[model samples]
Target: MTLDPRLNAFRPDLADRRLEGQVEARHFVDGRPERVTVSSAALRREPRPDAAQETEALFGEDVLVFETTEEGWSWVQLQADSYVGWIASAALGPRGDGPTHLIAVPRTLLFPGPDIKLPPLMGLPMGALVTVTGEAEDRNARYGLTTPTGAVVTQHLAPFGGAADNFVTVAEQFLGVPYLWGGKTTLGIDCSGLVQVALAMAGIAAPRDTDMQERALGTRLAGIEPLRRGDLVFWKGHVGIMLDGQILLHANAHHMMTAREPLSEAIARTAARGSAVTSIRRLG
Candidate 1:
């Protein structure tokens, strides 16, 4: 019964108080809740800035901070997917009221005021959460007034709990986005990141890596069954979503970006590299 470090806050010296009896540590403490305040903050495997980034904490996502170091790093676990890692302390703040909305589009500008003509404060990626206090209209475009200050295009946001009809369509919107090993935003994304983010929009809570996903998601299809849209295809360490019976869409290193190609071509290429399709899963 080994606990996964990626989902548990534990180290040789310290651990979450909740795991008191299950794990051994020199000390344990109850973690304080916090919220991500930056557009995106790298969750690294180590506290150092140069450490390998394992994932990202998007703006407004809640987390439990187990420890903070003088060097400005915080060991925390994301509330959305339970991934644990070290994030910059500055990227976190007091967890206020829960988020009211999430960015539904690939990305949207956050203006300083209600007017779109003003310089934008930042660009919020899809899945970034925000608390909309009210609405404002300028010229013809409408905006949602976010807490503290900042305005975002009203149409680009969807209320919390609102789910997209098809997660596959959400994944399709990221076509051509650059491939990145640990990225989860439109600027760049990885295979599992793409799947996790897209499935989230459709109200499906998925794990963060291909192995986790392959084990936890949907029902496995038999080798002889016909493939269809939304089926997930897995290889040794990679994954892709089926666009239809014949096409596969994924953010892959081979393409260096999100791309769509015939499933047979992907199979041939992967097989040539000494891997074959390990499984196909159909979401229930």
Candidate 2:
């Protein structure tokens, strides 16, 4: 039977007849639609602070609120990635409007006011979707965008649309960003996060994790085919994009940062560690 793509078995889908391994058909317990209010909210494995963080919900993203606990955590499934996890209840609010602009740059600061001299309200990572309320001129006559959080320079945002032509360039921008498990922001990002964000800016939709990405994105290359720019090479739990035929760019724990290296070197080093390249895909 074909299962719902979003059904990770944590949430009830009666038609699929599964919920965390139970085969009984059931209905949602207390599902409600909510919008993320914070810049980024952690989606944890359990409804507790010490639980492993599984993913994140960016500001303005909508989620299905399934259940809430007395400990102040709520089970939610992100609308974008359909990834389910527990998040702080305080980070969400009643459903709201969608986003108007996509954070195009690697990182942009949200200022408490229109002026840049003031302290920033928070920082938004690349690929964040934000709604613009109004526009005003900064001291230098540059356009400033007023959002729910505050203001950001107009240049930092782009109208949401098809992928850009420079995915490699976009990936290179996060060269020094630290590697974090389940992170999708410039503050700390995983290999999949780096690929997803870079491709997102270029107008392609990407799944949130390496395994899903390997299964869903791009066309598989033949065993003897030559690699080209934008090719995706994947191992068991890791992914890297080809900057060219010979160079691979990825966010890796080895360097503890995003870095580019020779593809041959990567394949050899990874093989030594017992994880060989499982597949290579090319996306249009």
Best by lDDT: 1
Query: What TM-score would every model get versus the actual structure?
Result: 0.98, 0.90
CA displacement after TM-score superposition, residue 262 of candidate 2 (Å): 0.7
Candidate 1, TM-score vs. the true structure?
Answer: 0.98
Pairs that collide, model 2: 162-203, 163-202, 163-203, 164-202
Q: Model 1: residues >4 Å from true position, as ranges?
A: none
- List the candidate 2 regions with Cα displacement exceeding 4 Å: 2-27, 147-149
Cα misplacement distance, residue 91 of candidate 2 (Å): 1.7
Per residue, candidate 2 scores C-alpha lDDT tens digits across 1-284 of 54443444243342222343444446535458898877788898878888887777887788888777788998777887788788999999976456788788878888877788888888877777777888877665344565564787888888767457788788889888999888888788889988887887887778888988999999999969889999999999999999899999999998898989999999999999999999999997
For every model in order, what is the number of clashing pairs?
0, 4
Q: Which ten residues in a row have the lowest lDDT in candidate 1?
A: 140-149
Output the lDDT of residue 35, model 2.
87
